[model samples]
Every structure is written in structure tokens, then in C-alpha cells.
Target: MYRILIADDEPMIRKGLQKLVEQSGQSMTSIRTAENGFHALQQIQEERPDFVFTDIRMPKMDGLELCRQLAELDSDIQIVVISGYGDFEYAQKCLSYGVKEYLLKPVSKKAVHDVLDKLVRVSARQRTDTFVPVSRLEQWIAEMDDLVWSLREPELELLLEKLRKELHHYSLKLARFCDVLEELNLLLAKRLSTRDVFSLQTHLDLGGARDVEEAWSRFAEGIWSIVRDLKARRKGRAKDPVEEAKHYIEEHLAEEVSLEEVAEYIGLNASYFSQLFKQSTQETFVQYRTRRRMEKAKKLLQQPHYRITDISGEVGYADHPHFTKTFKKYTGFLPSEYRQNLGIE
Candidate 1:
């Protein structure tokens, strides 16, 4: 069982996400809500939740700052960003701060349940990830990436053994430690073929390990787990990344999304995702996004209550004239003209 902390300025959002998570049937020790990032941090320090679901826009600290600070802490708190359709671009930025998972504004039970599922699977031992501020890990990242990528077990073993011997020479300070850990996490994430970003932290206790041998064992196990999981995947057919990208695009029709952001979201190289997307859908990512936006705009235009100006923003077109031109090009009718034919002034 684990605890969860939900943070948002909107009381309704906080309450709604909390309700969905409760209904997800995940074992939870406690569930709490915070009005803003400040309160969220306070709860984080006091309750020590295993997961945090936060919104990008909040009253005091905002999700960006909250995540930035949390990224620096030597804890294993999984963060999931929640944002409105229009704020996805901003929400997407949170991924850089040691966050790999996010849910759109309209929270679904399946999304909530899926994130919890990943947490459970990764934490099978009830203790899989706990980051430490160690400097030596940074230098080994490039070499380790090659070793893990090629699945060179012997070289990998030799490297870790050498690393184990040098652990005693390292000295850690909080300020510098967090930066190193963050860098290590990001670097490893780039090399990983996992579905999304997952952290690589040692299982050793935060304060101390029983002995040097125990610490080395815990750290080595974490590294080996990556190589083993990749080996297993190589034997099986990987899931279709293009389908996942399409779903992500359909959900974020309002945000200004780029090919790179979507690629990073699903843990694929941008160039690779581009090639696969075109081969599968016969449309470039840009072409797909444009078509989706026009479709969304048409639907909004059908609603008489939604103003033309607002409709443009809803479909990700900020400049009114540009949206008008694009709408005309897509449907051969301006938004105003389209609404006019529907008999609404």
C-alpha cells in the first residue's frame, strides 16, 4: 500500500482525480489533496506519499517549481503531470524534471489505473527505486549505455565490479548530489527503450547500507534489471508506437505539439517515430496534427455557444487570421461562414 498526494488550484480537479484514483482499486494507505504547490510540498514532507499527481498551473508554487524541487530530493516519488488541452505544451515541459508520466485534463480511470500498474510492476519488491547523489555514476553513464545497449554481460560485470570498488572514494554533498542524480537519470532514460521514462535508482537504504557489499549488491541488481528486461523484450514483438502517438495527438488537439515531444513521450527516437508514423499512417506528424485540429475546430464551430475567436484557440490556432485562412483551406469555408450555413448568427 502507498499514499498519494493530489495538487491543483481547482478544488474540483483535486477532488475528481482523487476520486478516480480511489476507484482504481490500487492499494493505498492514504489519499490527500492540496490547493496549490506549496501545500503539496508540505504534504509531501509530512505524509511521504509514493506518488504525486500535479497540475501545471497552481496558485503559489506551480507544478513546474514543485517538480523541480522534488527532482532534487533523494526520494522515489513518482510524478504524473495533469494539464488541460490548452496547457499541454507547458505540461509537456515538466517531463524534463525527472517526470515521465502525465495525464490529460479529463482524467480517466484507466489512465489512473495504468500509471499505478507501472508503479506496482516496477516496485515488485516494494522497493525498486531510491536515488542517491553520487558523482561517479555520471562518468560511467556513456560506458554503461554502450554495455547495456549491446547486452555485453561480461563487460557490464567488469564495469560494475570496478565501480563497486570505487564507491568508498566518493563524497556526496546535497546540492551537488541532486544535480548528478538528475543528470544520471536523464542520461539513462535516453538510452532506455522502455515504454516511457523509468528511473534507475539503487535499492539501498537512503541513510546507509548494511555494509559495502550489501550496497554494491543493491546497486548492481538495479543495473542488471535493465539489461535483463531489454533481453526479454528483444525476444518479443514490440507494441506499435505509431498507434500510441496517434492517441496522444488526438488527446492534445489544443496544444502546440512537436514531433520530438511526442517521440520523447513514448520513449522513441524522434527520427524513428517519424519514419514509423509515416509508414503506418501515410501522413507526416505535422499533416496528422493539422487534420486533427481542423476536425476539432469544425466540431467546436457546430456548437453555437462557442465564439469564433475562442474556437481558434481551442484548436491551437492563436492568430485569428491564420486560423481563418487555415480553416478556409481545409474546409473551403471560413469558420464564420461554416457557422453561418448552420443558421446560427
Candidate 2:
């Protein structure tokens, strides 16, 4: 649920916004009002609502000055200015404050709802860090499969673990994660054994990964060629059993998560899955999950709307210190430091 603060001198305007926020849905719980910008700042300091709606013209401090002061306090605070005057200079000043969006006074309920919807969408995308399209995960999975097929026993174990951690941390699906692994295993054990070097080259010619897109196509074509060669020598590919396991990890990141539990989710024997996963990704599943959780913690920390405790839980860290330790290991800065730097940048 989101906490909202409405700061307007007019009693009627404040009541109207309060009712509108309630009517928006159950996602909003705490709704507070301040008669002026000064009170608004004090309420914000004490409560720290996720969003603030204030009238540009207020007693003591105007919305522009209030936003300026609020940014000094917490730059990440979302401010929407509401004023009947609609001065261009005031609106221009808001951009400097990093206000996400602004609203003119004579506030319409529809306008408020529109802004809220936009905020939710931005928040959701930011949470996922879906910077790379969801489609890209499949490609990375394919690349992991190819890399795994060419490696020997000990080396394979190390690589697989690394891949597993990266996948889990990034929240890639288990089925997709496992499918590429399985495909590589099948190709390496069977195809690579009997095929000659020239024969393997012929295979690469099919979807020659010559171009940038094809080079990083995220498919097992390049790896399948090696498997084709090994299989001819009567070397058979090992079947990847961890396909279902990766999906389980991603779906349950917020819960009590561990490699053993992840293995159990896909009905795999724990020790075997751990070994195979390590062989394929060159990382332990635990390391990858922690890395990812910390990344999320970093992003969430950058948003002032979320407290450290909430961020800890949100990113799958059981304790703040633990989260802090892992976060610093991955990014050199504590979560709070990372956030503070982000504001300055």
C-alpha cells in the first residue's frame, strides 16, 4: 500500500483529495493532510509518505519553496504541485527538483488518478530492473548452455554454478534456465563424440554467429555443434536435470530460499543439482541469488519511498547487516551510500 500526503490550505481541497485517494483502491492506506506547506513538510518528515500533493500557493512557504526544502531533506520524494495560478515559472522550477509529475490546481480527480497510475507502472518496471527485455533472459540461458558443453569435469562444475547464480540473481525462470542446460548436455554427450572438426565447422555455418545479433543470439546452436562432434566418438551427452529447478528459484526469491530448497522444488536430489548447476554456470546458486537480491536492494534503496527495513525484506535479505554486507561486496558501497550517491549524481 502507498502512503499519500495532501497539503493544501483549503479544507475542501484537502478533503477532496483524501476521498479520491481512498476511492482509487486498497493499495493506498495512510492518507494525511496539512493545511499549509510548513505543516506538510513537518508531516512529511515524521510520516514520509510515498507521494505528496501540495498547492503551489500556501502560507509561510509556497509549494516551490516547500519542494526545494523537501529535496534537501529527501530528493527522492515525489511532489505534485497543485495551484490555481499555474505559473510557468513555478512549473519550470519543479523540473529542477526532480518532481516526477506536476498537476495544476482546480484539481480534478481524474488527473490525480492518472498520475498515480503512471507512478505505479514506473515503480513496477523499476522494481524488476527489466532493463533487459524479458526476452533477453532466454538468450543468456542459451549462451550458458553452449559454454557448459565444452568444459571438462571440474571446470564444468565451476562454470555451471556461476551461471546458476547469475540467472537466479537476475530472476530468470527455471524452466527456461534448465532447458538450455539440458540441450547443451544432450549435444555434448552425443553429437560431439562422433563428429570431426570439419563437421563441426559445417554445423556453425548454419546460423553462423557472424553478426552481432547472431553472435549473442542466446541459442544453443554454437554449443550444439561441439556436442555433435563429441557424440560421434561414442561420447554421450549428459542430460541436464536442473531444468525445473531454476523456475522454482525465481518464483520464490522473497521466501526462505536456498539451493537445497530450489532443488527440492524441481524434485531433484540436492547434491547432484548443486554439482551440475555449478558445472554449468560457474557459480553457486546461493552466490547468484545473493548477488541479485543485493542488486534489487541497491535499486530500492535509491527510492526514498522505501525504508531500509522494507527494502531488506523486499530483496530477500533476512537482516539489514547481512544485506549491507552482501550489497557492499557486490557494489563497493553500502546501500545507503549507493542511494545518497545516486541523488547527487
Per-model tally of clashing residue pairs:
0, 48
How does residue 25 of candidate 2 score in lDDT?
61
Please give, for residues 100-185, the per-residue lDDT of candidate 1 as tens digits.
88888688889889988887675444342333334556567778877776678899899877765554445433322333333554
lDDT, model 1:
0.74
Per-residue lDDT of model 2, residues 211-281, tens digit only: 22232233335444444543442234333445445555656666668886765544345676677777776
Cα deviation at 43, candidate 1, in Å, is 1.1
The residue ranges of model 1 lying beyond 4 angstroms of the native Cα positions read: 125-345
Error at 194, model 2, angstroms = 60
Name model 2 segments beyond 4 Å from true: 130-345
Candidate 1 clash pair list: none
What TM-score does candidate 1 reach? 0.38
Per-residue lDDT value at 176 in model 2: 27
lDDT of each: 0.74, 0.63
| CA shift of 184, model 1, Å | 30
